[model samples]
Target: MKKVYTISEVASLLGKSKETLRRWDKSGKLCALREPMSNYRYYKKEQLSFFEEFNNHQIQDSIDIKPQGDYNVLELFAGAGGLAIGLEQAGLKCAALNEIDHWAAETLRFNRPHWNVLEGDIREISFSGLRGKVDVVTGGFPCQAFSYAGKKLGLQDARGTLFYEFARAVQETSPAICIGENVRGLLNHDGGKTLKGMISILDEIGYRVIDPKVLKAIYYKVPQKRERLILVGVRKDIEIDFEYPQPTKATYTLKDALKKGELFNEDVPLSPGAKYPVSKKKILELVPPGGYWRDLPLDLQKEYMQKSFFLGGGKTGIARRISWDEPSLTLTCSPAQKQTERCHPEETRPFTVREYARIQTFPDNWKFAGPVSSQYKQIGNAVPVNLAKAIGESIVKFLNEKRLIEQSEKSLIAI
Candidate 1:
């Protein structure tokens, strides 16, 4: 997992000659970074499109695990039911979903009337009634720092945080397995103490926590280059191992997301979208496809970026225009936000609502219930539907194995 590569190393990795790379750099096809002290040209691991190894895992055939019998999932912090939809598609039933947001809850109830959408604060809800009925418990809890006391952090130390609620639900429901998902930054939050604390808390609650994994959405049929850190725990009594859904060899791009292609059967439906202010629009119009603030002319770059222009590190997301051939950068809670602009390749405006849904792999028919800004937040914060389905399939596989083991043990006892 090297983050920066020398030109020669990149040439070897991409199976290209140094001369060709130099030409591509000069042509702006594959930009190379220059070392500040040595001025030596290098390539960032992400800039090399042909190198799939940067995903940091072996690509395997897609998984197709089916449930052995009816399996039920109890979802928490279930914003708009993205995970629930995916799990349902993978043959698991959604027994209940608790979302604190009124709009997200309304969206879930609107789409799936049968779903038990519990709207309100998670802290006020109780899962003890469904203790043994739920096969799995899933939540995308917000990451927060826990007060440290000893070598191991306990559940009580995480009180007042959303994660505590998630852990509490897991303890109360007593499911065969539990899952927690969060942004990739969670791995390093609080200099890694936050994740370690979570692991220790799960361990204390009669569950064996697995090493967390950051699954890239691009490898799981998602058109956007999003990543989610997945934390999985198995109840101590279950001996079955849970494998992450294997990454697929296939890749997708913005074109696949918005046009009639493999990712979608029809072009993205027409819908309302955010428009850049005239001043921002003027600057972005100068940027070509796949280009960012650096692509702008010197004066415009300075004007558009302001103080950030003088800052270190590549502010590549600013004024970015996504290329049709590339997967979009991870979306934020707001598309029109200056820090992470997601401009359409050809259009000067932001992606429309339906287009945003398509990029997240939501079914075209699935509707959001909220104001335009609220809708964007729901979609942006969601686990991409296709990626969630992949995870769900893996969970189903684990449960299938557990079911078989339990059945065999019962038969042996009878004999």
Candidate 2:
């Protein structure tokens, strides 16, 4: 008989939170069977043997989209096209995409000449032409709070906010579904008041907000420890519930990112990258794979870390060398920052542009324009391609069920 494991037991043994494991189950990234009598769940250990080294097993929900179908979508705040690329891969056709950054707008048009790329401040544009025509409307809108006028939040108060532009697009597009994504911090922003205001605005617009959830990138096959909060809204008239995508197993590592593995199949292609100062490089050279400032010689650690050495808490990200065996710390805007350091495992340098893209699960063929630093910034700020793909699949699943409901109603009317 295969060894059986309880959810809590597996979570403990892996050094991960139970909620992460439960989310994996909910997303269908891992398979578990319920106990016959108690209805408690158990995972058959044999199925997870492949991940014994890392104790990381995944259960991906069955939301897969291919190229044949046409899902007309309008994307707002489309930065560097990360989400757009993922959606396109999932059979969605880009009807139009809007971005404020000049370079990101240029990058989109450069990649797809025929695309209707709207490059300007969103406040200036009108979305009236798209009403009720698109299948899905999506964006990574910056989280902003709408001032409360009465007990309920009003759309007028949200006027100057970017989310208002997103909501306005939704109000105008009237798509069957809309997806909003943001950094994990958005969940607790303004002590969670920001999110509540968003929900109220969405509700006031006739869309029912689904229970939103945060997704950890490490669980979705990306080799980086990043997190994103996703907000899904279905038109109130639609009866179907939107299920978030399941995470896949990590077939990647910092080694896979900078070197080669199941993720890249070839070592990271050479590209321009940030360089460390001679002093910082010398200190980091003493650290080993997966080790941080603590791994350095006590005297050298103090010299390099300065006053930070006296600070409380783990200070784990400082002078840390990534490991072939573990996921990377989250990427920051600047790769070589003194405090939020992301060091390469074997080398004393920082991760390069290609390495950054690989960690974000971006394909090699996908190009990044502009100077080296801007390229890193774009990749760092992006939603991981694979993570977005899983999300795209989930959106397809949710919408398909909704389409079925419409069919049922029409059939009854005809009869």
Candidate 3:
């Protein structure tokens, strides 16, 4: 029912950058109209139909297709349990989880005491014991390119990388489906050979790899503009097609995240947060909401950016302050880093630990384990819980369809 979308919304919807949209507007290709009130770029829904990528617009209401039976997932590289919790919310049980980080494993165990948290190197852990027990094998493996001599990469060739471990788990378990989650840059990492290698390895392991997709977190009800590349593979025997979840028209803003809104029942609880040094705080105060280093005074810009001021790129995240009306830029490992400063809209400080968790769509009760710095690292590195939930729903839908097909085939065999 939404007729118009802001430049940010359109960017997420079309999987294009705002800069690209501006370029299109300048060239008279998909021109944008200025909103009368704020003078911001906006596009009517009709204008988007011309693009091939705009074919799917199915909203969130219809995407929550329930599972036909109990489903279990064996999660690898389970950091802070973000994806695990989301899958749990979507009616999938965590049969087991493998996390190498001690703190993250502790967080997982602390949150869900019953969850089987295999704490140690994934290389040392064998998932062969879980063969045929788990319906899905999922992992957010860190992107690492395999060394190759122009030969097609295989499972053995990926030995040193975490992805190899993920594939090993999938092969050991022979799950009905497998998912690989990573940053969007993986598509272009090492000139796209890394991804091509990943597909080749998955195929060699007796799975059918589907084309990868970059799912913007904002489209899946997360209050951040983080984009994750999802790579799904079906076991060679599974006949059902795997479909990605459709984007929702509804979007949430920073205000919706921090304050009591539809996303949360109550205002964000105050907690310990990172602080900027006197020098950085002084410079950041000049930036307005939804602004970055570009908005600072001329002299201050040079002083703050120093050598980087002369750099070619936008450097938009420097001294950035999020606007209440807009979703936040992607969160980094540390909130107060010089390159990616996520300053509060009203206050000139990094978001509180709770606020950081909230922005990542973590529940209030989901207490993070470790020091403040470690906590930020865990929350920032996590997949937005809401986005994970949306993905979980899609997985459940796929498994449910597979279940029905198997049941029908069994019935025919009996007859």
lDDT of each: 0.87, 0.79, 0.88
Per-model tally of clashing residue pairs:
0, 8, 0
Error of 1 at 377 (Å): 0.6
Candidate 1 Cα misplacement greater than 4 A, ranges = 1-60
lDDT at 290, model 3: 75
- Name the runs in model 3 displaced over 4 angstroms: 1-60
For candidate 1, give the lDDT of residue 40: 88
Model 2 whole-model lDDT (C-alpha atoms): 0.79
**Deviation of model 2 at 109, angstroms:** 1.7
> What would the per-residue lDDT of candidate 3 be over residues 1-415, giving only the tens digit for each residue?
7788888777656755566677899999989999799887889989998764454443545546788899999999999988998999999999999988888888999999999999999999888999989999999999998986566778999999999999999999999999989999999999999999999999999999888999988777888888999999999889878988887756778999999989999999989999999988988899888778888889988888899999897767778888887788889889888768999999999999999999999999999999999899999899899989989999999999999999999999999
Q: Worst ten-residue run, lDDT, model 1?
A: 11-20
Estimate, for each residue in 1-415, the C-alpha lDDT of model 2 and write its tens digit.
Answer: 3288776446433534444566778898776789789989887877566664234344433535553345688999988888888887676788999988877787788778888999999999998898867889999998876675567786777888999989999999899899999998998888887888888889989899998898877666677778899998899988778887765644456766666667777888888899999988888888887677887888987887788888876677888887776678789878997778888887789998888888898888878878887788888888888788778877777766766677788999999
Q: Estimate each model's TM-score.
A: 0.88, 0.84, 0.92
Worst 10-residue lDDT window for candidate 2 reads 52-61
Q: Per TM-score, what order, best first? A: 3, 1, 2
